[model samples]
Target: MLWVKSLHIIFVVAWFAGLFYLPRIFVNLAMETEAASRQRLLLMARKLFRFMTLLAVPAIVFGLWLFLGYGIGKGPGQGWMHAKLALVLVLIGYHHGCGVLLRKFERGVNTRSHVFYRWFNELPVLVLAAVVILVVVKPF
Candidate 1:
């Protein structure tokens, strides 16, 4: 169980790194007026998205294992885990949203301003803060 938890933390960090950086790529993609830079950023975004998604699967699987196998939140005192899971679900949606944006950027059809993407990039930071607090503080 300890090993599984350790791996879960590793993959979660990996996945969050991708999420954090990918939007910055989008910020560059949205700002780059040169075709060469656009192509390079597009390629980078695609590969990062793929690799991060791979990390996400195992992170989620291990989380589910912790929940089901260890019964971390099934009892009366661990309501924080439920909120943490809800936040994780929201993060998954955010991840999927990034994929949609990635496709839009790939096709050269992205309409959002680089400023918009700069703002968008802050979102995961907030989520990460909330999740870490919920888990570490276990505040309900």
Candidate 2:
């Protein structure tokens, strides 16, 4: 169980690294005027998105293992677990949304400005903070 927890933490951190930076890449993509730079950023975004998805799969599996197999938060007084799970789902949606944004960029159809991406980049940080608080503090 401890090993599973450790692995979950590792993969989650790895995934979050991508989540944190992909939008910054979008910020660059939105602002980039040079075709070469745009293509380069697109390549980087594609690779990172794929890698992050790989990391996310294991993280989610390990999380389910802890919750379902180990019963880490199955019983009463576990509202925090539910909250964390909700936020995790939100993160997953955000990850998919990043892919959608990347596709738009690939098609040269991106409409949002760099400023929108700058604000968008803050979402994961806020969600991460909330999740950490829910896990560590469990202040239900």
Candidate 3:
């Protein structure tokens, strides 16, 4: 069980690292104005997004297993587990949003700006931080 928990934590960290970095790549990609440059950026973004998605699956599965197998209940009112769950949902939304954006990019849409991506990138970081705090500190 402890090994499972450790693996879960490691995978979650790996997933978060990818999540945080992919958006930064998006920010740069959005800045490219030339067609060739944009295409290159799109390719990179696609690969990175795919990688992140792959990482996310195991992290989520392991996390669910940890939560269920370890008997860690959803936190009580105003509890840390509740906060973590909320942030996890937000992360899920962020992941889905990335998928939407990736699909749009693949379709040759060129509407998103670097500024937009930069701001968007901050969201996952914030949510990940909240999750880490909730898990580590268990603050209520």
All candidates: TM-score: 0.97, 0.99, 0.89
lDDT of 3: 0.79
Per-residue lDDT of 1-140 in model 1, one digit per residue for the tens?
A: 99989999999999999999999999999889999988999999999999999999999999999889998778888888988999999999999999999999888789999999999999889989999998899876
Q: What root-mean-square deviation over C-alphas does model 2 reach?
A: 0.5
**TM-score, ranked from best to worst:** 2, 1, 3
lDDT of 3 by residue, 45-71 (tens): 888888888888888887788778776
Note the Cα lDDT for every prediction shown. Answer: 0.93, 0.97, 0.79
Task: Output the better candidate (1/2) by lDDT.
Answer: 2
- Of models 1 and 3, which has the larger lDDT? 1
Write down the TM-score for model 1. 0.97
Task: Name the weakest run of 10 consecutive residues (lDDT summed) in model 2.
Answer: 69-78
What lDDT does candidate 1 reach at residue 49?
A: 97
Q: Which parts of model 1 are misplaced by more than 4 Å?
A: none
Expressed as tens digits, the lDDT of each residue in 1-140 for candidate 2 is 89999999999999999999999999999999999988899999999999999999999999999999999977889999999999999999999999999999999999999999999999999999999999999887
Query: Which consecutive 10 residues in model 1 have the weakest lDDT in total?
Result: 71-80
